[model samples]
Target: MKSKGFGKKALDLLFPPRCQGCGKLIDRDDGLCGACLAKYGDEQRESCPVCGRTARECSCGAAALGSSFIGNRRYCAMTFYNEYNADSERITEKLIFRLKRKNSSSLTDFFAREAAAEIMRLMQLSEERPEEWIITWPPRTPRAVLEYGYDQSEAVARRISYYTGIPWKKMLVRTGGREQKGLGAEEREANVSTLALLRRKEADRKRFILFDDVITTGATVREAADLLYGAGAEAVFPVCIAKTLLKEKTDDEGVFV
Candidate 1:
């Protein structure tokens, strides 16, 4: 244990930990600085009065779930995403951008910790056994994989499995399709239709925690959930790092208050 502590100190000296959000020096590794965490973390969370669920988990918005399949599935996210927000330095979006454009162990590790906690919440909410549930993510487009050299969702899912002792598998494949970013709701739905089951036999009678980086219009995840259902999945619970906030939640200034 002394040797381990010595090694950690040496490593810290060589490469001092910095906040993944703003590059501020920090005492810990693989996490955000306290200032950044306080400014952009769960302190900003809002809840729905009627459902007593966080903004991400609330289903009160009329346009929240664009897919019937998603409407029926249990889902939640770590935070809210509002692209139109005036704050250009929003750490949630910045972290997500870093997650896609680079291979940052700190960022992935941070997401994994959050994902593991959220997955456990979903498991408890659904009364499902942790050992019986499987972790899976929709494979990124071929173009994305080639450009980024990694799948962000899969990376987080694997890390979650490592931390939580749950099994992670590659269950769904994206058969060459247009990127979902910057697309309208209908367009996103059409693009997600390209997803197909990679292993139908493996999915039989299993419950899945569908992990993804973001949930917008609920198209991609919903389609993935439908494929899993068709393949005989007993239940599908969707979880993501961020969820697009409904218009009402976004103030006139385009900020999520």
Candidate 2:
């Protein structure tokens, strides 16, 4: 006789759920597929909230770069993409690998959900009063967006907005700046922050969290934040999916508050 267990029934109903990470069929309902999930299990690790590195390194790492415009501000993220440099600067670096090449729809959702959960945690821990939190990512020039087909940062942010219920808008634009990822470590540090502005409307709200897929040099996001601050935004906090955990010297401190 067959077992009448509900677990067996649920499994049959889903009939081999697909994995979010590698796109393989799995026997569970977890966030990721088995193989792909395990592959990145080690890839994704805890990051420092203060500096978006490791918890232990947060003290020194964040303090060293705490001189930039958004330096002293508080933002929460699930992981840090900037840390990918120590390992590799390849095109498929960090979140780019899963979201782009793998074509994993669930993968981006996984990131958004994780980030939303972290944000919730931070709000509870710090007792941040929720007036209104807008979620926006670094914008791309029309030419760049046409070239890439889609901006992975904004795509991930869109999914995040759906999951977290936080309003996201096109409040920041990108001026013609050097690609932060392609630059060498030193060049990445030397590039100045230049955030383009978005015209405001009647329904527009302030107090926002800038979202990005990854934060390597932090220059790109910093530039975006500068633009928002200049446009009468009450506050701008950045949230990247992943951050660089590697050791490096920073002249600009990544932020200035």
Candidate 3:
């Protein structure tokens, strides 16, 4: 059998490491090149710390707000993309789409590290830390998984677990449902309402931080939080890599305009 070191060298030779953001060849697999890394340095400044919306337009409603979820739950996100601005939003969307659809390993690692940092910040800001905090995710439907050949949320969750030293579990299972994409706001909520169930005996009064790739309408994560809360979780925190913000437009007789 080939030695482990030799095998690693051979693999590296066959497929060189590339930067996650720009796909440029890099020395390591874990980070973006300096230029790509610089792009995300101001992400927090571009997003609302409270609502995870872009600074220019962030009127988050009660349901859409992360703190309004059940069971003393709160939501937080890493970056916000304003949909009306195609130039900026496309940059965010490209990263997310590559991660979800292409299963980009470097992007996954990058997001996982970012998420771990956010969790750490939350822990520091919390009034009292929980006895134990577990990592979990709202699973994708089996059909979607089969079609995509991977689960994006699960991938990120495992990486977050690795980075934070918190245990990760597949606590929720999707009970087959239509895809949430292209659905209206209410339809999106209804589509995902009964889609996920807590795995048997997995939620035993533990605190959970549910991870996802993005938060558009907040319906999917809300449903997942409801399941965790129902399964006796003491608290549920929803975390995402990106938050989508709706653009504001005035009507013909808009007084504010």
Q: Of the candidates shown, which would achieve the greatest lDDT relative to the real structure?
A: 1
lDDT per residue (tens digit) for residues 120-234 in model 1: 7656765757898788998878768867899999998999999888899999987855765688998777764378899999888987888888887677877898889898888
Candidate 3 residue spans exceeding 4 A from truth = 7-9, 47-73, 82-90, 127-131, 178-194, 246-257
After superposition, the stretches of candidate 2 with alpha carbons farther than 4 Å from their true spots are 1-17, 27-31, 35-73, 80-95, 100-104, 175-195, 200-205, 248-257
Q: For each predicted model, how many residue pairs clash, with residues at least 3 apart or on different chains?
A: 0, 17, 0
Better of 2 and 3 by lDDT: 3
Q: TM-scores of the models, in the given order?
A: 0.78, 0.66, 0.76
For candidate 2, what is the TM-score?
0.66
Tens digits of per-residue lDDT, candidate 2, 1-257, equal 26666565575585666665444676765556655555555545555444464531243234332222233335443444543432353322544555643434556677777777766656556666544677887775544565556767777788878877777787766555465666888886766444567665411346777887766666776667666666667777767665565454443333322
| Per-residue lDDT of model 3, residues 1-64, tens digit only | 3776667557768888887667789887776787767676665457554445553233343344
Q: What is candidate 1's local distance difference test score?
A: 0.74
Q: Which candidate ranks first by TM-score, i.e. highest?
A: 1
Q: Give the TM-score of candidate 3.
A: 0.76
